[model samples]
Target: AQSVAQPEDQVNVAEGNPLTVKCTYSVSGNPYLFWYVQYPNRGLQFLLKYITGDNLVKGSYGFEAEFNKSQTSFHLKKPSALVSDSALYFCAVRDIRSYIPTFGRGTSLIVHP
Candidate 1:
């Protein structure tokens, strides 16, 4: 079975500070990892993806993630956080057996002004 876990339900950070959202995954075979963001009542927007390349993958909105195969983790990171960066984030994984990816429950990132 393939699954994704976002340990945090919410992350509160002040503007101009670095932020990170934890994510861990389990899969049977090779996994395609992805990060997505969603605003209120809006569909998820792709942030980044790690297929097979460098361990560090950058994405939209100055977001980046580190893929650690041994730890089975892909944690999202940003050096500086902004008020507009506040949004709901979801981590997903697609296994070789299936095309559809399994998404995490979602972590709310509140970047206060």
Candidate 2:
């Protein structure tokens, strides 16, 4: 079975400050990791993904994630956060053998002014 955990229930940051949302995953075989952000009453929007290749992957809205195999982690990062960035963030992992993907509980980000 594959699973993903977003350790923090909420992450608070001031506008213009860097922010991070932590995620760790477990899988039996090679892992496919992804990050998504959701606004109020909106569906999840794709942020980034790590299937293979470089350790660092960049995505929409000035966000990026670093894939660490040894640590089983793929934490989302932004050099500077905006109030608009506040939303529900999710991490998902898919195993090559499985057709379905496992998603995290989601972490709420609050960007304060």
Candidate 3:
């Protein structure tokens, strides 16, 4: 089974400050981790993924995440937060053998200007 956990239901940050959304996962084999952001009434947009290379991975909208093998974690990060960055963020984990990925409940990121 593959599972992802977003511990916090919501995260608040000021504009221009760095922000993080915590995520953890469990899988049987190699884990493929992904981060996505959902705008209200819109579909989830792919942010980043940890597939093969370095533990530290960067992605769209200046987002990044570090994959910790030992902890089975993949927490998303942003150098600076924007009010526009406020959205629902989701963490997903997939087992290579599985066709579909399992997503977390999602974290609501609120960036105040």
Candidate 4:
């Protein structure tokens, strides 16, 4: 079964500092990795994706991710953090065999102003 793992339950960062949210995935074939952010009660919003191309992929909200095939990891990164960026982040993975993505439990990011 395809699955994702978010090792951290929460990550704390100061405003203006960089932040990272780690994710690891397991799939039968080439995996489609994604990152999503949810603010309070809002739905999961797409952050970044790694379909095909350069390992380094960029997405909304000044977020970027590096897809490492060897490690089966896709770690989300931001050059600087803001208090508004504090939210619940979920990592997901899917394969051609599955139409739905398997998501990690989620990691909460707290940015202190």
Off by over 4 Å in 1: none
Which residue pairs overlap in candidate 2's backbone?
A: none
- Full-model lDDT for every candidate: 0.96, 0.97, 0.96, 0.96
TM-score for all models, in order of appearance: 0.97, 0.99, 0.98, 0.98
User: Which has the better lDDT: candidate 2, or candidate 4?
Assistant: 2
Q: Compared with the true structure, what per-residue lDDT tens digits does model 2 show for residues 4-76?
A: 9999999999999999999999999999999999999999999999999999999999999999999999999
Candidate 1, residue 59: the lDDT equals 96
Judged by lDDT, which candidate is best?
A: 2
The Cα RMSD of model 2 versus the native structure comes to 0.5
Worst 10 residues of 1 by lDDT: 92-101
Clashes of 1: 0
Which tens-of-lDDT digit does each residue in 75-99 have in candidate 1?
A: 9999999999989999999997797
Q: On residues 21-113, what C-alpha lDDT tens digit does candidate 3 reach at each position?
A: 999999999999999999999999999999988999999999999999999999999989999999999999999999999999999999999
In model 3, the runs with Cα more than 4 Å from the true position are: none
Model 3 misses residue 80 by how many Å?
0.9
lDDT of 4 by residue, 1-113 (tens): 89899999999999999999999999999889999999998999999899988999999999999999999999999999999999999999999678999999999999999
